[model samples]
Target chain A: MKFGVVTFPGSNCDYDAYAAVRHILKEEVEFLWHKSEDLKGCDVVVLPGGFSYGDYLRAGAIARFSPIMNRVIKFASAGGMVIGICNGFQVLTESGLLPGALIRNTHLRFSCKFVNLKVENNATPYTSACRRGEIIRIPIAHGEGNYYNFVGDIKALEDSGRVVFRYVNSRGEAAIEANPNGSINNIAGIINEEGNVLGMMPHPERAVEDILGSADGLKVFESIRAACASLLNTVGGK
Target chain B: MNNDSKKAVVYVRLKDGVLDPQGITIQKALVQMGYKDFLSVRSGRFFELEIKADSADIDRKVDEICSKLLANPVIEKFEVEKK
Candidate 1:
């Protein structure tokens, strides 16, 4: 499967996502410039982590207005799979592709470290490879990773089983201290109701290689690659 | 040519119940500096825009921009002032 990584002007993780797909996952991947309003006939689209547009106004706020975002939104509306990581998560929220908003970290500090994320639900295409309650070590580096939504919306997210990943400790417990950012309900990632779009604050692409510290993040990509292949086969597509 | 450009000042602040870590940090700093008699502190952002004079319906235009771009309605509220 082909993966298209959107590259906003200030995006620094484009190459990382590209390398993760090309080398680790052995998939076709290319950089989709922010100004290009095309998906390049890719199976999946990845909004890599970085301070897009220099995090102007707010994290991912300015980058949301990029010319390519229109096409991305259209693609998502058509049920295409899209993944947003770190600042990309912020952009997804800003673009209305995902629910809620990402605000400043509760500690008011740029958190840069590896955090444990437990798979809350393994039903979605992104996490189908992961078993429920399984923990993965991924590096999270962001200053505005705090997720917030209205109380009703939070309840709906839980009721609908859209919360895909939650911050947890080594024991896979969603303890308060384990939450790197003060995301509501310790959310590390979430998927939309349609399940085609995902937004997470951690950099899975950065952790897809053992040499980079951990290869646990590769499971997420592998899950998508395998799922997409099966989906194509079921639909009689190559 | 007349200077028909008008200014619209916008103030964006987090909604009530939403935690403001920056505001909390500032409050802590103030307390450490020996200041007292404070219920709480909140933080916000603002923007100044010079509207073109020929643009009609300034109020609606400003409100649209504020809600759609200047402030995230999910977490923050924005107030626009014509100047």
Candidate 2:
């Protein structure tokens, strides 16, 4: 399956995302620039983490209006898979492809470190490779990773099983101490109502290899690959 | 003496019941340091502005800033106190 990673001007994680897909997962990966409107015939599109546009006007505010986002939104709406990591998640939220907004870290500082995340739900295409309640360690580097939505919207997300991950302690227990960025309900990641788009604060690309001290994040990519492959097979057969 | 001299203090804060992630993070750190007496914490932004516009105009300007730039109305509320 072909995987496409969008690169904005200041997107530093594009290479890492490409490396994880091309070298680690051994998938056909393409790097698409932010200005390009076309997704290059790829089934899965990834918005990797980084300080896009220097994060000048809010983390993902400026990047959301990029020309390529139009196509990305259409692609996602059409039931294609789209994943946004960190600032990518910010962009997705700003683009209205995902619910909620990313606010400044409650501590009002940039956080950079490894954090434990509990898989809240494994039914979505992004987390289907992992079992429910599994804990994975990933790195999160952001100044605005706190997620907030209306209480009613949050309840709907919880009811619909759209919450995919939550901050957790090393023991896999949910607690405020495990929350590095103060996301609501310790949310580390979430999916849209349609289940095709995912926006998460943690960077899976940085944790996909053993050399990175963890290969736990590989399952996220693997899950997307399997889901996209199944989708392609279904389309081909039809 | 300037007739239009006026000052306003703008207090921006997360709305009630909205999660203050940054504040929660700090509260946890403080607790780790054994400062357990703190019941809750919330962080906010404060801005003091001296403007020459009329009070009505100042109110409108403050609203513009709150809606467009200074504060995200989706999760925050801003109050302008005239001085």
Candidate 3:
């Protein structure tokens, strides 16, 4: 499976995600420049973490207007895999590929630390390898990771099982203390209705190695690879 | 004199139910400094835009910018004032 990592100006974690896929996951990976409209036929497109476009108007606000976003939207509309991490998550919401918006942390400070996340749902391609209610430690670094959705849409998201991950404690319980950024309902990650796209604030790529503190994040990448291969086999069998 | 140049101000604010952490922080700091007369606080942003009066439907254009770019309609509300 080919992975495409987008490199927007001010994107710092693009290489990290690229390295994780190419070296660790042993997959073909390419860097998709923000100005270019080509996805290079990648199976999965990753919008990595960073303060894209200096987060000028707002986090991921200006970057959403980049020329490549038009193609990204098209790719996602066709059931292509897309992962938006950190500021990438913000861009997803801004571009209307995902629901809800990320706002300022309730503490109004940049939080950088390892937090626990529970796999709220395991049916989506993104979290297929994760067991429901399993807790994984991942680092989050951002000032605007707080997730906010209206009460009505919140219910719809929950009812649809689109709430993929939530802040949790060591025992795999969603607790108030585990909520690092004050995100509503402690949402750490969510997938769109079609289950082709995932937008999350946690740095899963940053946690792909045990030397980096935890290797729990590797399962996320493995799940995608498994899902992609399964998809190819399903088509080949026809 | 040019007849096309005009000014428009866009005000962007978070919706009522959304929490304004920055504003709440500021309010707390004020209380610590002995200015506790305020009931609540909220934070927002504004932008000054210069547009062409001859452009097709300036109101519609400004509204589009506000909704699509200047303000996040999910958590924010925007107002465009024309002069």
Q: Report the alpha-carbon TM-score of model 3 versus the true structure.
A: 0.97
Write one digit per residue (lDDT tens) for candidate 3, span A1-238: 8999999999999999999998899999999999999999899999999999999988999989998888999999999999999999999999999999999998888999999999989998888888988888889999999999999999999999999989998887778898999988999999999999999999999999899999888889999999999998988822
Per-residue lDDT of model 1, residues B42-80, tens digit only: 989789898788898879888888888999988999888
The regions of model 3 sitting more than 4 angstroms off are: B1-4
Position A191, candidate 1: lDDT: 98
Q: How high is the TM-score of chain A in model 2?
A: 0.97
Which residue pairs show collisions in model 2? A106-B21, A106-B22, A107-B22
lDDT of 2 by residue, A21-78 (tens): 9999999999999999989998899998888889875678778778988899899999
Residues B1-83, candidate 2: write the lDDT tens digits. 36677877888888898777668877888999999999788988788777775556667877787565555667778888888
C-alpha DockQ of every model: 0.90, 0.23, 0.92
List of clashing residue pairs for candidate 1: none
TM-score of chain B of each: 0.90, 0.76, 0.91
Q: What TM-score goes with each of the models?
A: 0.97, 0.79, 0.97
Cα miss at A97, model 2 (Å)?
0.9
TM-score of chain B of 3: 0.91
Interface RMSD of each: 0.7, 3.4, 0.6
Instruction: Identify the runs in model 1 with alpha carbons over 4 angstroms from their true place.
Output: none
